[model samples]
Target chain A: MLNIVQRFMKRLVRQFFKKKKKVKIGLYGPPNGGKTTLANRICEDWLGEEMGSVSAIEHETREIKIKEEISVKSGKKELKFNLVDTPGIATKIDYEDFVKKGMSEKKAKQRAKEATKGVIDAIKWLDEMDVVIVVLDGTKDPYSQVNITIVGNLAARDIPVLIVCNKMDLKKAKKKKIEAAFPQYDVVPISAKTGKNIDKFYEALFVIAG
Target chain B: MSLTLQFVPYGEIENLDSTAKVNKLIKIVKEEKIILLEGRIEKNEETLLIKKTMEEIGPKFKGIELFVMYPKDEESDPIQRLKKSVVDMLLGNRQGLTIIGPATIVKEIRKDPDKIQLLTKNLSKRKKTPASRSKSTKKKTKTKKRK
Candidate 1:
């Protein structure tokens, strides 16, 4: 009877938190910064599936991808939220560049138009984000305009943010640069490609989302 | 490392529509050169430029880097306010320029207190020079090429 009562109390607490409004978590970053890769990692770990495809090509995620009801557990604490993987934010997109990548002119132009729409949509979607994870390539300079924009937008919206300095598996990955770039927020260095130091990411997410 | 800097000049804002201006900007950026844009584009125009620019980028071009500077204003329209916040988010770390390209130079557009700055660092000497100005003479060349 004691064990049964304990299980009953746990269920009651779970249901109570579950009844609260769902939190929306957005993954935003520049092209090839591992936003989708990190989303895939989170989804694979919790939801047992992939979020979207990743590519070396720029703007591979030309659309906003979403997964709902992702419950991440760290210790006894459980945090549930929706994961939104936005298109890579960029200042410019050119089809001629795509043409050089071996794509036909027509297809490249089509991609350009879609990617433009995707960026606008991603910015618009910012209103809906409850919490955001600004992912960055740890090997690259964290002070780029794209990185600044992601953080600025989040701050403007008064949304809580966690900076994920991704690609730590690379020999050149520097987590300090990212931390130095935004000293106000928490920065987690992880490799979404190789799943390195992901547990810390989960712990960070729990604190931000909880 | 020894580097050759290419400077792409901006045109009159009154002359070109957002799309035309962005298209021209993309063309210049495609040459793997840094291009500077000033008060010619507004908040919406910048958004449109980003949209159009991303659409044209391919595997060869890799990506384009943007740096912007705006006066710190306490009073702005809702949209302007949002753009400022967006700009802050996009251009978060402001120190010196950062390089993230080689295949195509369309990299680094910076704005300053009084003037706009661009640094187009071409990594591969594969492409021929396309009527670009040297880093030292960027100011003079920009004045000479102005519309």
Candidate 2:
């Protein structure tokens, strides 16, 4: 009788865990490199609503922002992804915007200091990620601060890093340059603004994200 | 077998002391096959991080988001809702997901950036965050305490 109860409990627990399903993705890139644009593109298909802010200002994102519960469906399989967008990565930070909000210059400076933490935060995500979308700017070459660090770091973690070369609509986009630099990984040249190569991007994500 | 994990830095982290947020995150992240948290967070944000780290790695990898946050605003208080704004920019229906700071802020983000450096080192070196460190490894020291 005890064995029967144990078996029943085991079955119950198994069912509970097996029924659960989902996926999470972290968006990363340099300042003004269009990280949020990619995230918005992903979620737009899910909720048909634009998520996150896109702007020309550098370091627009200060802290780590996570969007919980994004439902992504690939045919019969479904995934719940929590999209987290990042702040820009530069060598220095400006506290003026923060200070304008009534914070003391000292606190503003301190807050400005904290804003720079995004770079390290970007690295830490590798251990915690299953799939890394290294959003790239097609208008520019692939070798730069954020690109080098992002690709190099993702490769080190052995995490599947998908190179999304964004802004392909621009005439200056040179996909070959980035593809040549990181030939080891899969590079998908795309335009986040127009949703070009989005389908291909998702197909790749579905396989690697698994 | 080693659980392969991947990560990407995207957004920022804030809202200390919100267990509900963490719990909700845990629920969502626990569903993945593996979980990884990348990038740098402030000293004050560590506790909140552990809370979510527990969430993202609940069961463990194969299907998880490489969530990353780039910080922009940095006020000590919730005055401008920088956290919210950051989220808004990253995932909450905004135009661009970026942080606005000066040159000092850029170079400064990399200083003594052990956590940040740990991440970069782990990625570039292909080692674990603490495992890579021969140093007694920084304990789960509280990030920056609320001023």
Candidate 3:
């Protein structure tokens, strides 16, 4: 059929262009998992700028933001990639949750609408990523359904993954739990807020990207 | 006011493809029923299921909570593992349990190596009496006036 041939041509073009461009490193995780904080950390370390804003509220980064031409170095080796900061993926978006956080009902409804679209966008962007950094709140259980879904999608795509167990500065942050949950992937514990063990994260990035 | 738990055996959905299987599951969850599936789906199917759930989110239909529990092969002996592989090849992997529920009802689904614990939301807390509603409204008005 004409549609099948067109699809094949499109995929071929995408594959050819993918090899020509810089590696796209994506930050993906559940809502409020400190993805934007990690994005800011990476951008500030390399470009002396922040990618987006961070908030205590969930779904704060409800759009996909990208920082191009970020070249990370570990000793003499350097890896060049475009760092993509995606909205936190979630299965549910309730306006009442924002209202409970002291947002007006009208504003909460608007946020919920945007968040729903954000989740869809995040999923759609999964296929375009060359590498993904899955950020998890270290204090929470890593065996949640959302975490499994995110990791499973990456595995299915055969994309290299690096799981960052963030918020290590918190007393309740148990790095072992995340390690135990996902033994297949390399788990690096870091406090994105404090930049703790972030060097190790960059070091591990080279290994995975290689 | 009521909760429904739908038990679906593997035979019921064995013939369906991945998209069909996810669609069937989402259709049930959209009706606010918790599904206790006999066997676990593939990893890619789980991802597809989440994508479909996000697409269907709305005011009334929130989303779904999914969990799967299976026996760990690491704990089994080599012979036992071989037997499981053979059986799995013959009859599919029907040794695991999958739970999918509407997020409006299921608050969380916690799983360890051996068991699954499903925590439901407290629906009673959402019901407000007329007197309590009026009292809260009056408190809000007083705060607005003070502001």
Candidate 4:
């Protein structure tokens, strides 16, 4: 009788874990590089909702936000994963930078503290990521210290990466520049704000994370 | 493995004038070498670089690539990470290179991160004879294009 109950409990636990199993896909990058915007775009496409709010201000997302069971289907192919949107990673964060953007001193300092903590939390969570998408500004130069560090850590961990070169609708957006910068990784150029070439972004995700 | 060159700015990179730094970057990239930078460039400087590289140099040069490093906190231990996670029930903290090379010979940059693939074929490096070139260029418009 006890053995029957133990076997039943074991099967129940196994089913629970199997139901909860989902691949983790993380969106990571610098502040205002549109990590949240892209996250919102993906969630809206699959889940019919947004993951989090976005702002022009830096470090607007000071905590890790997650949306689960986002299953993307392309024809017969289906990819299901948990989407994690992390705070922008910066080597330095200063309250004065926020102050210059017209934020009050007290709020700016508070934001800085939270943002700094957020950065650490993002790094800690890297170990749990099954795949990572490093979203970047296509108009900006790809060769920067922050970009290197993020890619390097991913490389060290052997995690798959899909580089999203966002903001391609702008005249200054140069997807080719980003391609040249990180020739090793696959890069998908898209305008998250305008939803340009988003289909290609989805296609690349199937190839990369699927 | 392919040949690569790397550059790291030591302390006080900010003291240098932004324009001069961009000019220096342009000169380095034009040399057709794969180079890695130590840190992120300023936003205005990054914009200036893309504008200048595209407009002045034209299609021959491939665009710049960026890689950002992950930040490290005070603790390196796994136990400490878990402990902090528990403490984070109390407190919190957070978040997140340059790769430059010429396009023609350097084909793809790989996961090795620093390694670039170079073309084994020497077709682009070959010199052309005028008569042979003229014979190949049957179109008159094509003949005058390069000159």
lDDT of 1 by residue, A1-210 (tens): 674787577556545654576878899888889999999999999999999998877778889998998998877888888999999887667777687888899998888778767887888797777789999999988877667767876774457899999999999999998997798899999999999999999989888778
Poorest 10 consecutive residues by lDDT, candidate 3 chain A: A6-15
RMSD of each: 12.9, 20.4, 7.0, 19.6
Q: For model 3, how many clashes? A: 0
Estimate every model's Cα lDDT from 0 to 1. 0.73, 0.55, 0.87, 0.71
Q: TM-score winner between 2 and 3, please give it.
A: 3
How many angstroms is residue B111 displaced in model 1 relative to the true structure, after the best TM-score fit?
9.7
Per-prediction DockQ scores?
0.23, 0.03, 0.54, 0.04
Highest DockQ model number: 3
| C-alpha lDDT (0 to 100) for residue B2 of candidate 1 | 39
lDDT of 2 by residue, B101-120 (tens): 11211222221323432121
Instruction: Give the interface-residue alpha carbon RMSD of model 2.
Output: 14.7
Rank order by TM-score, top first? Answer: 3, 1, 4, 2
Chain B alone vs. reference chain B, TM-score for every model: 0.47, 0.25, 0.79, 0.48
TM-scores for the candidates: 0.63, 0.49, 0.87, 0.56
* Model 1 DockQ class: incorrect
Q: Considering DockQ, which of the candidate structures 1 and 4 is the better prediction for this target?
A: 1
In candidate 4, stretches whose alpha carbon ends up further than 4 angstroms from where it belongs are A1-20, B1-147
Per-model tally of clashing residue pairs? 21, 100, 0, 34
Q: Among all windows of ten consecutive residues in candidate 2 chain A, which has the lowest summed lDDT? A: A14-23
Give the poorly placed runs of model 2, Cα more than 4 Å off.
A1-22, A94-114, B1-147
Model 3 residue runs over 4 Å out of place are A1-19, B126-147
Question: How do the residues A1-210 of candidate 4 rate in per-residue lDDT, one tens digit apiece?
Answer: 674787577557644553577778999988889999999999998999998999989999999999998999999999998999999876445576699999999998788778767876787788778789999999877765567668766865566899999998899999898888788888999999889999999999999877
